[model samples]
Target: MAGVLHRAALRTSRLLQCSKRPSRYHNGSLFFSTSSRRPLMALTGFTETQLTVRDAVSQVCSQFPNTYWQEHDENERDPTDFHATLAKDGWLGIALPEALGGSGLGISEATMMMQAIAESGAGMAGAQSIHANVYATQPLAKFGTAEQLESTIPNIISGRCRVCFGVTEPNSGLDTLRLATAASKQPDGSYRVTGQKIWITCAQVAAKMILLARTTPLEDVEKPSEGLSLFCIDLDRSKHSGLDMRRIKKMGGRAVDANEVFFDNYAIPADSLIGEEGQGFKIILHGMNAERCLLAGEALGLGYAALARATQYAQERTVFQRPIGMNQGIAHPLAEAYMRLEAAKLATYHAARLYDDGSVPAADVGVACNSAKYLAAEAAFAACERAVLTHGGMGYAVEYDVERYFRESLVPRIAPISREMILNYISEKVLGLPRSY
Candidate 1:
């Protein structure tokens, strides 16, 4: 697998080689066939398989243009049609194990697929509509019993059901090891859960939730990470009397709903537990690195999308008898943003490749993933801000679309993990400094 990926990377680099000729055409045509007119496949060392995934995902995304995303954002409606289209195309299974009806692709391809979705103008909202399925189930897929895999993975891949991740809480925030949600064991061996989870995306529509809760009180455990358990619980409110979710109106990514979830005596069968009890922290760590890699790719795509729009506007929008792109002030920042995004893209893809290779050390993978996510988020934010500035008055208008990109850029910066936390990690782990947090 590494040999094939290495060959494909070299092939992609050759394809991306820019000739010294004045004409934009390389040999005979543009580097990337996608409408975005950017060599995204080449930017991050795409394998042949990855290139195919990128193009196919980009084609799916092309059907849903900026106008489609604009209407969804304005109405704060779910992009179910877009999500359904991707599922129909079998993209939901891009990173799943083939034994369980998935495409069996690695995180590298998944990152490319997500980047294509965002670059095609779906932004974070479009990519996020189907993001959880790709990463949240990693624990279950690896450690789940045959019964769980046979029943659950197929439905998710085939779009018969949707799942949401429920790890964050209203009071705990980033202190995941200190989660307050509790799932007490009942006499019948079932579990009765009661707790609140905040900022849960897609709770309004998800049929299931991958939840983390304390099976034993913190005081009873030797360590804070102990006694925590993970469960795949039924989130269908109609079937469960105590399960409820209230939508939170957010600043961006309005197409998907974020909610505060309440579980009052929610009953889950004994079979719902994933992996061994008290090992939830260790199991979920696998998915967290995957999340960082995918999120970084999503951020890079959004940045490239904004930069593409700004570059086009600069070239076409005339001011004072000449295109604004003629001025160094306008062109230089866009150029810089492009360079920053490209650098982040490399980091993002490197982290993803490291994740898929599996030969790298776990500590190294964690550092790469967190650093890529942090850099990509910051770079994407700058690109969006510059895009808005390039459009001047029209940037704020929904029709222009940069404002939406700018709003959605904040998601990667804050979700899954924060920039500050990533820094603290690098400091203590890499620099061998004392723990700050």
Candidate 2:
């Protein structure tokens, strides 16, 4: 894994150099492949395997189209059939290793699957439904003990279990170091945790929780980031004592329930700790880039979906004895939206490839992933907005589904990390600017 990361950095550096300097055509011909010129495929340069994964996921998604997702969104219900269908088809473990009964692919493949899901018109609701299942297991895969891995990972891959990521707090927000969540060590080697978590996706339905809590008092630690630990706890949400989970209804992505959770005195066994004590922050950082990559891909898919819908409507809807698409007023915005989405899509996939390369430095991965996330979110939102405008009043109507797309597009701009934070990251980490926050 370390080698993979290192290689990723060198590969990225080389790509940058080539992009900056003129390419020397050592080959006799200067002609590039048609795939390079293609709009969507050019973004990712997906391998044959990845393309196959895309097609397969698309086929599965086609079963439950916009109509299916619209119903789920309107009812504010979980896309149980969509979620189960993907899990049943074994698409849930696209990121897990084959040894653990997974396909053993990388983040690129995972993003492809996720993007296809979103592009199927499932939108954020579709992507969020299975997002944690595909992602949150990595910390365990990379850092957990033998007994822990043997017991937990298989069930996750097989879709017998669902785990909710418990990290963000109501008050702490992005400043994780100051979170008040605490887990005191018990005489029996277990830990008693008490904390509040907000925006915990799928908490209402999750059977397990990958939790992070302060193991040692922050004042006692050398750094604020120290003294924290990660744990995987059995979270059967039947309103048990010391465990309280409540659903928080929101405007969009209603298919997946985001919740507020309170752990009054949750007891977790000693073996549930994912990695070494006081090192949870470092371990958790390992999967952050992957998370960003997946989110970026999802956003890209949504943008493209919106663009497709808008262009299709413009071509079909006739006004003044000609298709709306024939007019520059409608055609130009759709064209611009297409360009923006394609650019963002390229960045998103490029970051995914770099993440999968396993050779990039952590700092480098952070820059790429954050940039991709920011670009994809902005682009997707723009596309959705334009789609709504192109449809005019019909876009605002639920019958057309563009309004839903427009509403759900707001998710990527705010979640995982905010656009302002991404800008701050690039400025401080990449450009060597003084920390703004």
Question: Per-residue CA lDDT of candidate 2, range 91-144, in tens?
Answer: 777787666776678888899888878887888899998898888888888898
- The CA lDDT at 162 in model 2 is 81
Q: Which ten residues in a row have the lowest lDDT in candidate 2?
A: 25-34
Model 1: C-alpha RMSD to truth?
A: 4.7
> Cα deviation of 42 in candidate 2 (Å)?
4.6
* Candidate 2: Cα lDDT at 304: 77
Deviating ranges (above 4 Å) for candidate 1: 1-44
Model 2 residue runs over 4 Å out of place are: 1-44, 238-240
Per-candidate TM equals: 0.92, 0.90
What TM-score quantifies how close candidate 2 is to the native fold? 0.90
Q: Please give the lDDT score for candidate 1.
A: 0.84
